[model samples]
Target: MKSLLKALKRCAVAGAAALAVVSLQPVSSAQAAPAPVVGGTRAAQGEFPFMVRLSMGCGGALYTQQIVLTAAHCVGRTGANTSITATAGVVDLQSSSRIQVRSTYVYRAPGYNGDGKDWALIKLAQPINLPTLKIATTTQYNTGTFTVAGWGAASEGGSQQRYLLKATVPFVSDATCRSYSGYGGLIANEEICAGYTAGGVDTCQGDSGGPMFRRDSANQWIQVGIVSWGIGCARPNAPGVYTEVSTFASAIASAAAGL
Candidate 1:
């Protein structure tokens, strides 16, 4: 996994411009926008309230009463101070519960290269009263579907969602995703890939660190992945990859315990 991650970092550095060009295609010319999945009904109620929009320029999920989980890259390239805020039970961005961040804890894996172990926890000044989320423990993939919700751009190069948006996507196998040239072998054990390889139903820019959740036997949602990185919004053979929340369950539990 370490070697694979190193290779991925190297690839990201070497092909940064090419990757950016291929992933962030302009969608402004299109006459019609893909209809966003509506809230309520099938959508999980009160779930997005715990979902946080980080002031560090990324999105995240609130797992506990006082803990907000997000991507490590959102902290910025240099090891510098950054401010973050958390909002709870938010349905409409204009009129949602908001809270100021008290502290932040970033857990970079030992000898971490970059983007791996890309997870962080934000401590809120006050505890939220929403339902706590669960992290998956099984290695099951491509067996079930999951949902990804965030306040990200709808198109490749478009404006971020004013309100929260969500879409359901099927999980793709590592071997299948590994067959791609750009991101094939880079998919690590601590990550999972989803979205349509043909380019649709994906998380775009500003979606980083959002929650990717699957339904359990009881029909309750369990967080499986954290929106990490991808080639683009949705492109052929380029599925959105995320940090497996289950892989960092212990780290999250420990961090939350500290708060």
Candidate 2:
């Protein structure tokens, strides 16, 4: 049964592209990156107020009272939309204290063909009272250990969780990440990699568009990356890749202002 589950996990992670096309539409040609917590713990109710579970099996963070930051591949182009919903204020999906807001508009990164840029902003129909998450503008906070949270699968090829799960992954240098077999010259400046090379903790399926963040000098949580893609769920030498939030910080700010 254990071996069978592992096989299922690999199949699920490998078929991410097809899954994206069928349910998440307009995904990039590159491998789709969305996974749940593998080797993570359940988060407390108020641990991450800015964190939200996307109705479309992805994760996101509140950039403003009415704006959310996520992976571009997780949404459609810039336009009016009322279908996407953001659920926040609680870790447990079954909790009655949860706050729900629908998306009003989506602004995917310009020229986001899945080659490089993978970040997006979503304007909400109404503002939520939750504390918004701050994004990193410089590379200062791009290093070290980062926290990733989502309702994605608790194991590779596993089912999505009812409660938010979180795990910490160390930042893997671009040079080291690029050294991987399948990642040669593919790790762009707009992307960042994080995970254990030994293969343990990571973001698995259902965790797409989630925040990869850490506390700043001011002891405040600031987002540095967005869960984008990877080779597999949690395999050695195959770390989870994320959209380097700092690389497109300026553009994101401008877009958010316009939204």
Candidate 3:
């Protein structure tokens, strides 16, 4: 399978395969499980109740009691046949306390042209009382310590993580982020960059559709970005790029408010 992350990489270059999709492969136990969030540590149980694993092989954030916010590319169209299920309320995929919910409603942001703005909402069959991450209307995330969590591979081409992992990444300005070769004119206003220029930490495959967020003054976690795409898993000059959450706050509210 072609690396879904190659979308942003090869697209920015000439004569590339040109697949603008990111697909998650079902993790097999036979393959060694590396870790989640490169250069990060394991998250304590229940640290993030909103974090969930999509049975379709991706991660998501429970935006409300019944609505889950994730990347638009993670699942197919929202309809009766949308058979995706979410396992929530647990840190480990193997946890016995995990709650499963089938997606009864799905909405992919209409503005998702794939250049950026890759976000979606999935409504659960039933609501579950779990901590939720609010979408930020403020872009105070100019530069600060952001946290990204997922069950993705710890490194590029590495195995998927069995347990959840958390990592701290510093925000990189658009000016500095575009300074890298092959990335100029590729960074969109709908996207934000975070990580070290030297490369050490990032969210890899299977981590797509997950949240990249930070704490606010109210001591609450607010999502600022969604793991959308990257050139590779934590490489120099190529940091983790995400769908700027603030840009889509209205879109999110409009889609999820009435439901």
Candidate 4:
């Protein structure tokens, strides 16, 4: 498979990811500037209360008092592991208001290998009494504005952020995503793309497993995707790819029931 991102090894996967992140950073010697989503800004406290940080190096969202939604690649070598914990209900990770919950169950799609089915549901040992974000139930045009947040790196090859950062990324068609270099035939229905062709705002490492949300007609936030992979962090022609949440909503409902 084509490599997943920039520091790819730079901002890509590590830990339990069977595939170690491969650096896609252009061999350059200059220091990289700080960026959000790719060009985003710091979010205010409680702005994204649903955002959660996985202790193992990925991002996630609070699905319920006892469940968190994240990426399959983030739950250690297997979802069955019990060492995972999620810090929730805070913008700054170091905040005193944060509630930590150990994962009791981690469920990845039965067919998950690496590429397509990238989502996972984490059952917490206790509930975090906060408002939760809902999942989208149908497919829609991925061509408008969307929001993504994480404690991931602010830029490619940069260190993971200490505070939560957010950015508004425009959705790209599957064709647009596929047209990018290294992504020709890899775009799948279970995935969605969002970003700019100019290399500004985009998700980075540590941002993986975070939520890709949009405001619905009623002006309520609903999760449409889960941060999964990309070719680079906020690079021109490289957009962030996420697990299309709607495609797996049924599966999530079914699997989460067993929790």
Candidate 5:
């Protein structure tokens, strides 16, 4: 499938036939993915302090003051990497008040080979004062309306956005998502899907690794999914797939503790 990650970085145009072949492919790298959030609205300043923009064109959320949670496909093998920068605390990419932090190390999912297990963690050189996002440990917050935000493409095969964009999408059941053409065998039980059956709203390319969250009873944000892949940006019958955070909650906590 056209990865929602391609919305992160611009790539050479592929032939229509090639695009069709990739429609069934999982996101193996950050270079491939669909366009940005279609039919999304611009986010205001300080709206999402935990949101992070990776230098490789992906998105992430602050799991702690010094660690970030993102898609495994958006990063490389586990190791130290000073080159990967994380930009946060702003809605506009060009904002002067943005806080930039360099990654001290990266920990890609242990068995992430594309078919599920798409989460990763990046250790920053220092901690930031931004509030970290709470991750769901149960399926309680997995259903209903989810808010997805990113700097990915705004339309299918379009350019990335400079300002953060966001949109709300209703959750689609695993059975329903699998019933769609081209997705029958792709949706894993450890993954969550969300979007409209008629399309027009989703997390695209650059949105990879970003949080798909919902408000809890306390009216606080809690992350449920990590943007992973999709056939195309906001396409009909094809919803955006994400790594079910609850499935890896304990593992993520263990990883973060080490970081």
Candidate 6:
């Protein structure tokens, strides 16, 4: 199997303009085990610490009381008996509240490769009491102005954060993101890009599976994407790509039982 970053790089080069239509490989089950949780300060506004921390280790999102959205690459490769857990309402990993997963649903796109259509859903053992994020399907995201929050490393080759870190970034056009040869145009229709031209304010290792949110016309927050991969943390012209939540609106609704 190819490294997530390597697969993304291939997709970028192979189909730079049509990356949104590519299919990627599912994440291996052996690599799906939960990772250590990091702690940090809560975001000031439009921030959800629970959202970032719960799936940082598993690469998932809290979509409903019992639903979590994650990358197929993160869970599909696991065995039927594989167990996944989620931690919520946590600002400090050492002593934060958490929830174990009762079940998980990995939605593998037909003909999955290491570089295309990597997405999945996980069901929690119990419904969480915290606020759920609203899903946005309308094409409200475009160039400029967006935010990505996660528990990945703060810098490329840097150590992971102890707490959730939220970064402000701008969305890049498909044409711009495609220019990178390594991604192999793996960016598909159900994806979007966000980050800086200079290496800063981007998601790095351990940030996968987090939410990339945008404000809709109603001024309400909607989850637009799930963290995917990047060449590096906030590398110039190498914005991080995410599974476009809006594109999978029906799938998410269906998986969550219309949550």
Give the TM-score of each candidate: 0.76, 0.85, 0.84, 0.86, 0.86, 0.75
Which residue pairs clash within candidate 3?
A: none
Q: Which clashing pairs does model 2 show?
A: 34-205, 35-204, 35-205, 35-207, 36-152, 36-153, 36-204, 36-205
TM-score attained by model 2:
0.85
72-112, model 1: which lDDT tens digit per residue? 65554322233556555764555644444544444433334
After the best TM-score superposition of candidate 6, give how far the Cα of residue 57 lies from its true spot, in angstroms.
2.0
Q: What is the lDDT of residue 164 in candidate 3?
A: 82
lDDT of each: 0.58, 0.74, 0.69, 0.71, 0.75, 0.53
Candidates, ranked, TM-score: 4, 5, 2, 3, 1, 6
Q: Per-residue lDDT of 1-259 in model 3, one digit per residue for the tens?
A: 1134445321221110100111122112232222323636877888877887777667779899899998887766655534878888877777788899888877888856566767888888999888888888867754577788887766666666778888766666777667766456544668887766555667777787888877778889888888877777667667677888998898799889866
Q: Which window of 10 residues has the lowest lDDT sum in candidate 5?
A: 14-23
Task: Give the number of colliding residue pairs in candidate 3.
Answer: 0
Model 1 scores a C-alpha lDDT of 0.58
Ranking by lDDT: 5, 2, 4, 3, 1, 6
For model 2, residues 57-86, the per-residue Cα lDDT tens digits are 778899998999988777888899889998
Worst 10 residues of 2 by lDDT: 15-24
Better of 1 and 6 by lDDT: 1
Which of candidates 3 and 4 is the stronger one according to lDDT? Answer: 4
Per-candidate clash tally? 4, 8, 0, 10, 19, 40
Query: Is candidate 1 or 4 superior in lDDT?
Result: 4
- Cα RMSD, each candidate: 7.9, 8.7, 8.8, 6.5, 7.6, 9.8
Q: What lDDT would candidate 5 get against the real structure?
A: 0.75
Candidate 4: Cα lDDT at 92: 74
Prediction 1 TM-score vs. true: 0.76
Best by lDDT: 5
Worst 10 residues of 6 by lDDT: 14-23
Q: What is candidate 4's lDDT per residue for 95-188, written digit by digit as tens? A: 8878888887788777776777888888888789888888988885243567887777776666766677777766677776788887775547
Off by over 4 Å in 5: 1-39
